[model samples]
Target: MTLSRLACLLLAAAPLALSAPARAQAQGQPQGQASPAPGRTLRVAPHADLRTLDPVFASIVITRMHGLMIYETLFAWDSKLRPHPQMVESFSTSEDGLTWSFRLREGLRFHDGQPVTARDVIASLKRWMGRDTVGGKLAEYTAALEASDDRGFSLKLKRPTGMVPFALGSAVGQIPAIMRESDAATDPMKPVTDTIGSGPFRFNRAEWRSGARVVYDRNADYRPRAEPADGLAGGRVVKLDRVEWVIMPDPATAAAALQTGEIDIWEQPGQDLIPVIGRSREVRVERYSSLPNQAMLRPNHLYPPFNDPRARLALAYATDQADFLAAGFGDERWWKRCGSYFVCGGPNGTEAGAAGYAKPDLDTARRLLAESGYKGETLVLTSSYDIAHIGRMAEVAGEALRKIGMNVDVQFADWGTVTTRQANRGPVDQGGWNLFVTTASGATMQSPITNIGTNMACARAWAGWPCDEEAERLRNAVAEARDEAGRMAATEALHRRLAEMQPYRVLGQYDQPYARRANISGVLEAPVMVFWNIEKR
Candidate 1:
């Protein structure tokens, strides 16, 4: 699992370099699909394989996009960033604001041909609330979740919580996707076999070949709302009859395929290859997401040396955000130095807590490490080199840490294996990991209320599991604030506490550009990539 061994493995696993003619012939087009059918079938090369099928288990970008395609939510955020009714026909709260009632639109049917019901909605929300960091917090304020009728449900809260609708409609990772009661009853930690959803598209499970390809067919029975498509809200019209997600690990091959018109869209193209794509007359390179991705370095709180706050602070000081930004995004134009726990330029984004860890302070870092304890233990730096940015960031971090006289062990693997390994909480010598690098969409870090990385509740927090009582209290304060200003003030305080805790380090922000052929149209500019309104001309 060392870096050199990992490189050898990658070379062995990658598709061999082939001649242009051979490469073209290898992409066996679907039978009778030689001619472009415009809205019939759209071929795409996603950034990575769809590893986790259950949206509730993993919050990665690809999984979220898959969730958006196959499942429907009661509410959705509009272009104005306001919560709007999607599946919900109407909703209201009692005068006390403690009781909220909701009714779903009529004729909603699952991919399995079963009618959607309120009992399903109640069970689905209950299961989602138990897994999502924000939903778990919101659940603390709820007294009960009950179904009022076949098409309606009611939520009775212990106090006035205005975030109920927003929580259900959150655009962040792991959305509360509506599902049948039978499917929703699966254990939160386990994956469900049922892919049945009532969304605009249905998952073509028969064609899903784990690391190779995945397919989705249009749900003709779906009835879109009257409103026009806007963001993830409004009408979700499935213009393409079939959406094929072909996994190509090699960026050059993906770019070449896009150039040859074998692929309609490349969800994530390496920055260095943008020019190559632009040179192709038929291909167009553009920034696909509304929010820049937030890169992060997470340390395991269960094991040493990061278990100690001073040790975590030392590592944070030794690392430089600019180095990671430059390594991941070569050009200064695509990336920016961000010094905030929350996303910069957003409503709750602030630098209130980013004081000393903005730049590299190797001297201070060494001194702090010495002060914590002189014992030299190897710090495991787990990295997923499959992702170009993540791998570059890890190399930069490893170099920085070595300079500060720390023993470092750099282990490299694919992103899927890295994410799965991060959950192990044992000692590093056994099966646990000390540190890892990853990125989150800005949508996930906008506020303490929706941020999963900031969750500090003991045993119930996300992967890294850094528990800080002060940070937890401040997060609750942010959630309970009555006005926008109050919420902002509380958020700033929470950010300051997080800065002190050093649970995780925010490296920087970079745009992930997507490349597509000119014939494709109606690609929505959203935080999560969507395929509903897109067409192949």
Candidate 2:
């Protein structure tokens, strides 16, 4: 069905309303205290539901957004992609740069009222380092992470490198969110159910409904940074007394809510509905980040067909970036055809080895498939039904693969289920997936070390587990390069190798704008949507 027709159908349906009991539970009114002012609450229609609260466990954007509402990081990235101190009061590196010392800002406290300390920071970093791509790179250089006092901690590196702050401050991929030591002590593979954090808001777990809404109240005792908000850095002053995530999976329902002022912000509006939403003077659609979102086609590397490089190359040859972009995003103004493994127009964007597969070639794809000795194995393609663009991308991919004489099975599920099922490494009959479509912000694709898609660390690589010794060596070279020229050269080489290996297919890139009520102000332009520093005036 067309998105416009879907929007029309959904808009005709009556809007969903939040239950009164849920609101009362969210507010948690005390006996003697007066109710909060009407305008003090900010209701947001997020792109997806908040299923995974632990950011360390899953890399989903909704989970990361939830973590940002309550969790605080040691450092944060600014608009220029530079790292700055967020939780740290003071920090310095030794002359040789092998030792780094940091002291926590005074008055930092978790939602439970416990003081933030070096122990919490150490534990959080250790946990984050195990899962995140950039954090894993940082772990390779670390010798010891020790706490000197209640508020001070030091990281002793085995070798001097300049990526310490970047890893901790990364706004892309898995965020390095600091949690209480006890919560951080949970296994990295396991989800931490505790919601306690030291950020400007507190997660109201009592009011959370799985598919309906998630609530957060402002942390009254929270402290803000002195600097003004820039990107995800600086002060996180919460002007709103309460922030509620009213989950609206339907774009038309969310767009209508924004028009009626029932929802303060709609995080991601469908490209086709932008014109409809813009017709209302009460709502304004604005692109929040300068970086576009890059779409990827990832294949399971542990399975039979994709495990062979020739089969992977056949998939890439069959893919046409223009078709995927047009199918996923209807409007050309909102999307672009980019073949760069690293995002096009980014710092390290390049087309070193993209010439061969710049356009679709059915003959080459069939020839490669025949060479790979594939005996018509059914490729299971998993996609999310809730996310429109992702589901469209999967459909386009399935069509392309079938044209190349490959058996395809497209499976549709909710975003949470898709994310969970993609982690399995077994065969398709055993709950494993052969292919899926996903996306990453342009900021995350800017560097070889930061981009999880390019990781080839064998068992430790991203979900696909694409492993190559030469790709790993090139990635290390880019990370260890001291000068810009050296870094660029190493990056180009790595990009070339990646194009040959076909770890994942780059479909295209596009910018998605956020629609908000006109009265909403102080929305910071970061790679990810952040709720702090926003005023619902």
Candidate 3:
């Protein structure tokens, strides 16, 4: 299917036209609770908070999972990261490949029972256009957004955005379809009392049980697969009336709850409990593949002594991938050798430059560091210790750098703090930091519009010097590729370029290894991260 390629726009068109003021509003109206509850509810606890609910914002896995329930994008990706049409019934680009039109789906109504109009798209994009708006990042790519008809909208591009639809598939695409003028008055991201969305499920009351548990009742509007999914279809709507997501922060406690029936599902199942869950009589164990890298993010590789390609190569050579992988995850192989910035490596994963990839060349490393004109700058490496072994990764990488006449200053921080700091134009005083590992869910691997920019292009923008002009050009190309063939070729080219330059060393890919009891049925899994699709036992 031909997808609509929309870019991030920076200009504001109109507000969401919201109703409520900027004050702290109640979460949502508590209504139609099942038997206690009516709709199916599931429990989930990942390593971190999901990304923002506004699809246009940064594609955080957690946010996507939550937004998955309340929002709909123009294009959607299936389990295999394949783009699938959702909100838009049909869409096509113009002959010149600049303007695009979308035919909206009919009979679609937001949870508030309001008819979704084309203007909604414009307003959503407008709110997202401003700095830090939902799809704020889109401002960099898009020129303007204009609604054409009641049922469709038209997006004009200042530059050719051949990859707009895939972008629309992202979080920004899931913006509020029907916002009141008042809702748009203030920040659109704050929870709205009137949660309006046109999705399979509707928003319900959420109860935060003081870090111990959070329960959410479902809306009856939730429509299930009436037909079969090749075969595993035909379940009566859903089995459970309400899926109470007990946010057990402790993994072991989460497993224990699942075992004791305090909780029905263990979203963040620990490895220690994996064996027990597999053999449990009351629960069921299901397995799935994950993205190749456990820790896949770009580190600022442009600092002086290390800025030299040889120094960067030396760091890569010194890194022990096998030992690092073993320490991070005992048996997680979701990540293979990925030379490119894109995670969830495609068939083109092993293309040209990535063939003979992983080799721990200590001797070569030493030689390269010396050649890089080592003026002796302490390599200040920072990373997220939130993930199991990411801090350990910094240590390992630091040791490798130290071996080659490089003094490494390893500093670790919480994922959110580091991410927030970087998003707000990185640390200034520290000479932009020699090396740092940022936490990116989609970076690890995401579906549909998995361009190299959100994963790597932004890496350039975030690095000490944004990785230079040449790197930006290559990254933009990867983001702007029109078709699969063009995308594949460009991605391969990028992989080769980064590998040659050693922009950031590939630490590990994502293997979303979670624990679930024997009872939970109809749970869908995404390799890298994000777990919104699940059913209760």
Candidate 4:
């Protein structure tokens, strides 16, 4: 019902959307060539605008997409989810497993024509280890990360940590993107203005217009590995001469552009318009994300009502996943009812603590609210109207929270606004939020070590900042586990604690697909949609 109202609002808002010509100009396309020759230039309409240039600074999917285009990592995950060396030519670990030595591939050069060195890699690793979840765990055991030579580096740990290689190859959440030594030293909290890396594509800084358009040109100097491309690893052969990411906030406008061949690929087609696009012979719709994304309702643990674990558990128990999924995806086929906080079929995925996760009992919720003495506290629930999926989830969840007797204040803002606002840790009255809905790529939730949200490290924890010593202990145990059985046991314990704490309500896992013209090819069906190896012909 809320989405129906939002639809009418969207139609009224269409006129305000950016036009093709204006978008083309913003992307630095010539006046006459509103639609560039398809094969040479691949025009894309991403789901959101490229807000941040620095990949390590923000873990948002949009920013990560940009980072993947312009930067290269030392290691990457293959299609089979195995870690492989990307920038590194070879590596070895001591028998004790405390020291890891890595040698860089020869002739790795940044966009500015400077050669990539071990110092750059060391600096980047240090910065990323301070921010990323897996890297943070590695940092706990790391005694030193230093350059062994101009082309090699070494990481000495206090004890054996089997996760070092995996951490270096991590693909989600503040990815360990290698940058220039100077840019690597830039504060992780601040955005790096420069976009220089030894990736397949080079950022056209002169053409970037934040919320309007961003452009990248193929890097002819980039040296790909001899191995064939597999997922995020191996050779990233750039077939297109240029890639243009045009920002169109309205799905209707983006669909129209795609239908007219104005854009080659629609990174995320709105669910409401899928049927319309499917009817077109020129356009084809398909799922792109390798793993389903799980939308979550994160409750701020710093504020009233939600400050209590009982209140958190009560909200999680009361909420229904179907309501939110239906509102966001529109079709039942696009979503799965997974009560799991981890990826449903992933390594650590299980239904152990999920029995009551999706079983909504409003009576129980109200009683728990009474027990917790939630005295009419205003829960400021914010939603991102800019992204259709997130907006619908937030609206649906806001209604559900109201049904469970929450004093809900539903605020709709752009994704950028929501991202900025959700970071405020102050009181709700002082511009902080009590509840917000966001989704994680299945890659991020593969295991407890990779799932930043599940880590209950309080002051250093993600968004909601749920601090539970027992949860942290369980997570550490899983990280340090020597075998699969031990890992599963620790994960089960962690999941049980997560259920009780309910820091973030795992709404459900849903498939968000992309659309492309029949001629477009080489689109990788990976967790983070990549533009490399894509051919327009």
Taking all chains together, the TM-score of candidate 4 against the true structure is 0.94
- lDDT minimum window of 10 residues, candidate 4: 9-18
What Cα-based lDDT does every candidate model obtain? Answer: 0.82, 0.86, 0.51, 0.83
Q: Could you report the Cα RMSD, in angstroms, for every candidate shown?
A: 4.3, 2.7, 11.1, 2.9
Candidate 2 C-alpha lDDT tens digits along 35-142: 467599888988888888898777778898898889988999998788999998999999998999999999999888899999999999999989888888888889
Best by TM-score: 2
What is the Cα-based lDDT of residue 263 in candidate 3? Answer: 49
Q: How well is each residue in 468-491 modelled by candidate 3, as lDDT tens digits?
A: 455456656766777878877776
User: How many clashes in each structure?
Assistant: 0, 0, 57, 0
Candidate achieving the largest lDDT: 2
Candidate 4, superposed: residue stretches over 4 Å from native: 1-38
Better of 1 and 2 by TM-score: 2
Model 3 accuracy (lDDT, Cα): 0.51
Tens digit of lDDT per residue, candidate 1, span 1-537?
Answer: 243553454344334333434433444434444433545889899987887877876777788899999998888877545678989999999999999999999999998888999999988888888878867888889999988789988999998878887888887767889989998987887876678889999898876777667889888899999998888889999888899887788776776667767679999887766765677789888875666778888888887777788888887788878899888877788899887767888787798867777878889999888887737888888997667878989998889888988888889988788877887778876778988888887777876877778898867788888988898899988889999899988998998888888878888888888898999988877767899888777
Clashing pairs in 2: none
Which residues of candidate 2, in runs, are more than 4 Å off? 1-11, 14-36
Q: How are the candidates ranked when ordered by lDDT, highest leading?
A: 2, 4, 1, 3
Choose 3 or 4, whichever is better by lDDT.
4
Q: Is candidate 1 or candidate 4 better by TM-score?
A: 4
